[model samples]
Target: MHLYLVRHPRPIVAANTCYGSTDLEVTAEELALAHASLLPVLPKKAVLFSSPLRRCRELSASLAETLGCQAPTYDERLAEMHFGDWEMRSWDDIPRASVNAWSNDMVAYQPGGGESVLQVAQRVRAFRDELSGLNIEHAIVICHAGIIRLLAACEHGLSIPEMALYAAQKPHKIRYGELLVVDC
Candidate 1:
């Protein structure tokens, strides 16, 4: 299977804010830019999947129309890690001790009382397994940075717990609207 993992376009949110699973939308200009840039590079006949979040949904829907593929299958498992109470709060505002606790136990600790790293890895692993079962030639997944990282880890044959730790420890450097291709 060939997987095209695309991070959603830049969302309309303040810098340094914690916004996992917050359902933010992208600007019209950003969306247009993303679509135009991606259309030329993406395969014409790939299965489309996207996070249910507005940012990803908008981009995926546009791409599907342009590519003449079916509308993207909205998947909750593709959504970013739920940040719970930290949804829109600035990272600086979160307590240091709490952040420290999460760093110390990234796999188990639920930062912001949200889903743990292990929990996210489990769902992403399930999604990957299902995709493998389909045996598709190509698939395009419009999602967030965290999901992209976790999926990359999964592709590297990491165990779920190892995936959690890898994602938690690795720095996220994927830019908005970036596409990473992985063949499995």
Candidate 2:
């Protein structure tokens, strides 16, 4: 299967804010720019999936229309990691101790009392398995950077622990609205 993982356009949030699972929406211009940029490159027909978050949902809906594909199946599994108490908090404000603890145990530590890296990886793996069963030639997933990284890790056959660590420490080079293609 070919997976085209697309990170959503930037959300309307303050810089350096931790907005995992916050359900923020993108600006009209941002959404338009993303749709216009992606429309020409995307396949006209393929299964489409997207995070239920507004940031992704809006773009997915627009893309689905232009691509002549069915509306995206909004999958919770594609949502960004839940940050719990840390949602909307500025990154600089999170205590050093909590950050250190998460760094010490990236796989198991539930940062901000939310889901652990392992937890997110597990759900992503489940989604991947379910998608694989369909045996589709092409599929597009509109999601966040974290989900994209985990999906890539799954494609590489990484162990669960390895996936957690990789997700926690890997440099996130994917820009907002960028498309990453992975063949699995």
Candidate 3:
């Protein structure tokens, strides 16, 4: 039940637009940083899975190259929040009222065609349950901050607020992507 929650590398995008689930290119520098930071931190053998988004794909592939292996499998469950009409659009483009609504209660906000935070958690839980049965000693998931946020909140039983803080402060290689030890 060890997991390395990897936030995908940077993407080439405009300053304020959201690119959830979008096809975006990773920069050479990002790939370089991934090599420098994540590769050696991984075990000699590990299971790597990435969000289907292009940025995550490229990031995973970069690490795979460093490890001299093909990129691991793609998992749709790891994809970012489907922002629906807001895909690739800046926050300003989304109605301020709607944004405020989501800020107050995102659980009920499913704009355009996007999913709510709760919905994302539901899917992540299913994914987590599937992982519970695996013989994988180490598993790496290259996904969005939202995915990490939900996993921390639901699986680890942290409140949503605490999960937000954890996600904000944690780096890409959390605990050097180590398997955690809990007495409980």
lDDT by residue for model 3 (8-54), tens: 77778887997676778778887677657776666545677878888
Q: Using alpha carbons, what is the TM-score of model 2?
A: 0.97
Cα displacement (Å) at residue 50, model 3 = 1.0
* Candidate 2 residue-wise lDDT, 1-184, digit = tens: 8899999999999999999999998999999999988987888888999999999999999999989999899999999999889899998999989989988998899989999989999999899989999979989999999999999998777888898788888989998899998988
Q: Which candidate achieves the best TM-score against the true structure?
A: 1
lDDT of candidates 1 onward, in order: 0.94, 0.92, 0.68
lDDT per residue for candidate 1 within 15-117, as digits (tens), equals 9999998989899999999998899999997999999999999999999999989989999999999987988999999999998998889899998999998
Candidate 3 stretches with Cα past 4 Å from truth are: 68-71, 158-184
Q: Give the 10-residue window scoring lowest on summed lDDT in candidate 3.
A: 175-184
Q: Which runs in model 2 stand beyond 4 Å of their true positions? A: none
Show the lowest summed lDDT stretch of 10 residues, model 1: 155-164
Error of 3 at 72 (Å): 1.0
User: Distance from true position, residue 158, model 2, in Å?
Assistant: 1.6
Error of 1 at 182 (Å): 0.2
